[model samples]
Target: MVVESGGNARAGRPRAASAAQILEVAAQIADDDGLEAVSFRAIADRLGTSPMSVHRTTGGIDALRRELVAALVGDAIKAIDWPTGWREMCRTFAYALRDLLMRHPLVLEAHRQSALEAPGADDIAHRVVRALRDAGLCAEEAAYAYATLHDFVTGHVSIRLGRGDFESTTAPAERRGASVFVDHHDYDRRFETGISLLMSGIGATLAPRIRS
Candidate 1:
């Protein structure tokens, strides 16, 4: 079933309600019972308001989900302490994004593609690209590097958390001997190793150009 939008609900302004409060309650519902459980009625029930009020504030579920994703990405970006070197900065960002996804996997559910266009997304992208440019990568190369790094980190986290079609827990049960390949325990180390290898490869490829 699609998300409940509360279009037919009775109209009434909720007393002293705010968009932030609505989002907070909606996120809480999602975190507790998955994204499908979040609806205008659910949020209103939690906030002691009406479904129409919630819907009016959020403009329906899709917009609310987009806002939720944007808020989360913005906050996560603000919390990062960027390091000196480009590689280190990229590594830190990868870790930070991974951690944020792990903590609030439902935010991605709120809006899977929204994070790319989310408020703080451009800021983080600029920082990464600037770092790469400073490290001697041309604009195109820096953009590619940032995009690749972002996809790797986000994709890894999605699979790790079983957020996408790839359910880590159920994958082994679906096929014979798949459990051997589905090593859930070692993802932490694997993620680190993956980042290290990626950084190494980028540095090696750029060393010749940087030296010139």
Candidate 2:
């Protein structure tokens, strides 16, 4: 997505370097290629400027990668019309996050490389935990539920993108042992099933404590 750059540029000069513009180009490169393909030179080439210009505007590649993660997360979170009911809220959050990761699978790779915290991650976590609390989970349970849900969505998307441990090694015969097993093609159905099971498990295992 082309993020509109802010500020004006003088005639005959490249537009003033905006982080959003750099990230927009960078994201496209990462999506077309992979996260490793994103480089100062690549972004510069797209922006009609030198790599040094891109570096100066974004601090460095590491910083830029971190910013990219935060931007992607923040943008996706903002777009979600989060539901009020706890179960629906968790479902909505899961689907929204999964969709974002599918679109930009590189976000997970960038997140891994950065290792430093992304800015908006905490806010996203808080929203998830709040939903759990509304579901009658205690503070600790809410936190655990939030983490579990987040991991499930990200892990599901990662596997769908062929980043799973058995993606390359599972023998075809082994894969055929069970219907829907090792099958990445029908991810929507698989994901829905997984989420439904998780929601049910959470309600059955934890919601009762609150109701009791």
Candidate 3:
């Protein structure tokens, strides 16, 4: 059945396509080719349907891209159990986001676009902001912290992936009498140190202000 995004059912509804099916095909196209390769026509071709069918199901490429982001974010969210300490929650969440991006590298571009429009993306942002607010940050401070943390995590992943040096650059093996350090271990240690420094600074800055 032809399922248009508007949900308009004419006298002959045809078979309405499922949004999930459309998104899955679009994601496959994006992964196999790239985000630019994802179009209604491209997805339809991959799914053995006409472009109109995909457009009816997903609205357009923009809408389809946003759905892809939602799907990816949903997967990431499922990896974590929330309602814990805000700091720990956020740290784990950031790691989860990193893992998600790495798994679906092409989806990163869609994620960037979706972050500006998708309600699910905004929900994630709001969660981060709320966590900061709960940690004694004022509204403005919480907003700033959320933005900073988001940028930091996404930017770090971008660099790692862009450079194609996620392993060697992040943790190069020592030559000669090289110290006993592995890439993954180094990455974890440095990542934890950076998080600690940021949280420590935030705590110090807010302590006096909150007391005052």
Give all TM-scores, in the order shown.
Answer: 0.77, 0.78, 0.70
Cα-lDDT of candidate 3: 0.68
Clashing pairs in 1: none
- Give the per-residue lDDT of model 2 (tens digit) for 24-100: 88889888788778899888767766688889999989788777777887788778887677888889888987888
Candidate 3 per-residue C-alpha lDDT over 76-125 given as tens digits, one digit per residue, 9 for 90 to 100? 66656666656776776677777777777775776565444444567777
lDDT of 3 at 8: 30
Please give the TM-score that candidate 3 achieves against the real structure. 0.70
Off by over 4 Å in 2: 1-18, 113-119, 163-185
Q: List the residue pairs that clash in candidate 2.
A: none
lDDT of 1 by residue, 1-212 (tens): 12334353336654545887887777777777777788887887766678887788888887887677677778888888889989999998899988887777786565474445567678888999999999989999999999899889878987876644345554456662456556544677879988999899889978998789
- Cα lDDT computed for each candidate against the true fold: 0.77, 0.77, 0.68
RMSD of 2: 5.2
Indicate the residue-level lDDT of 126 in model 1: 92
Candidate 1: segments with Cα more than 4 A from true spot: 1-16, 33-36, 163-184
